[model samples]
Target: MIKIFEKRKIWYGISLAIMLIGLGFAIAFKGLNFGIDFKGGTILTFNMGEQVNQDKVQEVEKVISDFTKKYSARETNNTEIELIIQTGAIETEQVKELKTKVKEEFNLGDDYLVQEENISGSIGSELTRKAFIASILSCIAIAIYIAVRFEFEFGVAAIVALIHDLLITLSVYAILRIRINSPFIAAVMTILGYSMNDTIVIFDRIRENKKKLGKVETGELINSSISQTMRRSIYTSLSTLLTIMMMVILVPGIRELTVPLIIGIITGTYSSIFIASPIWATLRDKKDKKNPKAQYGKKKKTSEA
Candidate 1:
């Protein structure tokens, strides 16, 4: 028995430390690196007319760097040798000159400048708001589902674990200055669901054990439940992480999604095993303290024979 509940403070402390580090970074730094999808900017697409190699990417980045400090360049998935550049709003003549410079630099024809469009900061603001709302709503829905399926305490603990996973992921993003875009929001939503599923598995095990072992101490029951499910959780997270890592290595275009998946899986598994169960045990312990006879695992007979 790992005595997980007995060492609750250690787990909680570790999580608190991670969260604080991320918070400290966020405070010391200006904020997260919001990509054009969230911060809003102009999208410029160019067709090199040939496959864009790393050298080509570096050249495009150099050209873009001359225009705006806040910009991102990536090779698009289009079959037509596309490169997309996003940057803060620049003047009309500047856009024209940029096109000319790109054309001259690469010997590209006039039509090499495939598309140009501006995204308003207001629209980006709207997206940020919607993303926040969606996350809150999803958390609420998950809590409701877990509460109905198990107990309210379990639901709350699971939410805490999910939030912990979210904070850890965002911390990594902020620390690394990763771009937060539409794909990031989608990835976050996926992380929340994935994390919640791991938590539910452990909670399910705890609930089952509570019934089968009617007189076990709360901490012992929690430890046993976690121990029983820990292997399964580890295996599941590892398999998912391996798949995502392979995707991240093999598919460059989907790094935005795969990177977060990797972070979420590790944190999710940790929280499910170390955080959520301890929290539930603590909550149950508190409830037991409030009413001595209503201790966890103590079955009450309806009538004495």
Candidate 2:
């Protein structure tokens, strides 16, 4: 089998470098297009009485785009043309007006179906705040749980891995210009929980090894524990990925949700095994060095004297 954890430092360094590059892109580009969940905007979904043609859709989109451009009160720098459409619940009268205009312009009959959703600035602000709070709280809860289960160092290492996975995922979003919204928030939180679970499983094995192999090098022990747990982790992640892939490709109305889940699960699993355990081993080694009892011959000298 491939020795993934044999060069733990190199793997960790590569992951860190990818994360930093992604972070820089995010900072420089502001973010992948923050959806209306973060920055309030209107959403409209409609079907013409006749089969919708590309030419007609483009024409209608041009008019609606111009209308939004003039009426939009927010200072949005990048407002690209909107062609991709999806189904969503709408909640405002202005959306109805836009639909009416589209129908009139296209000379559509009553058979045309139109829907509109308008989110106010204040509500968007509240949603954004809640998302931020939830993410922080999740990290705190995971830290407490890990610390209680193993040790403080284990908890710290898990959190570092969690943060690393999150940043890397977000950076990809920024670079790809994916829309960030409530669903994205859900994805991030879900990944955090999943990542921590994987870390905990590995940590549990490490704890077992620590008890079994007394006085072994920390690095060697970590490597052994990780190797023992590698098969189970790969199996679990592959099963989950299969389900997510099915949803993304086969199911309608779930493409957005499944895409992020697939990305999160893959990255989360990788970080837990490679990033979290290695960092914990490194920290534990440092701690061991600081203690006289952990030295090679100190215990023997004390007993003899």
Candidate 3:
């Protein structure tokens, strides 16, 4: 009974406002921190014969800092240290030397483990290209599937809603200053699949309602379809979100993966119900108005005109 579609303009406006503000921040701040997955970096994992102390780690960090400056002969920003340390990448020789220094300082044995890895710029660029291509292909495939299952207009509306969700998610990351990396790409892809599923459900209901309520106005039919499926959509999205929230709060290393996922699922669900369905309803109404068959019922009048 609640006429959500009737207030489509207001909802659309709100979505646009949030998206624009996010866009502004992204453009100004350069969209959070792009990690080595896109910019190339080293990945190192160190294994210790004994548990390392914080002071030892700090001392090792300082030594690495001095060594990098002398080796590269470049003065880098302090912020770069945070990025580099998290990546855990250093040269093999450097790792061996660091192990020797640490062993002498802590009197450890050769059982200590140290690993080093380095990623080049070309490889990082290739990864960025692949991620972009995957996202585009996903959108195209979903558009084709929606069109085949419902109508072209419905498909277009779904794609638009999808874009809206992606942009909004990106904006949130930018505003919140989350680190962008491989996990972020995975989250984006997962959200894309999720939002598509939600859109398909609403589109299916619209198709069913259209066949059953032939005499109902297109807008009213859309409203009815959404109303019928609202509970299911909310319940499903909420349950998923709750699990993600738990992981983000309880887990230490996986916060990066879970945070973006939580944001994507919430916004994706909202867009499917509020943005995609309403736009499809409006388009369907316009199409029906132009079709004479859709305007008149199948029953014949008894010489009425």
- Model 3 gets an lDDT of 0.73
By TM-score: ranked, best first: 1, 2, 3
Point out the higher-scoring one by TM-score: 1 or 2.
1
Pick the lDDT winner.
1
Candidate 1: list runs displaced more than 4 Å.
Answer: 77-89, 298-305
For each of the candidates, the C-alpha root-mean-square deviation to the true structure, in angstroms, is 3.1, 6.1, 6.1
lDDT of 3 at 296: 25
Clashing pairs in 2: none
lDDT of each: 0.81, 0.72, 0.73
Worst 10 residues of 2 by lDDT: 72-81
**TM-score of candidate 3 on Cα atoms, chains taken together:** 0.78
lDDT string for model 2 (1-305, tens) is: 34555688688777778767777777788656676766766655555555444565567767667445422221111221122222232335545666788778877777555444666667878998998899889899988988998889899999999888887787677667676778888888889988888889999988887777766656677778888998999999999999888877666345556777887898899998889987887777677679756542111222554
Candidate 3 lDDT over residue span 241-294, tens digit each:
999988876664566688889999999899988999888767766776698566
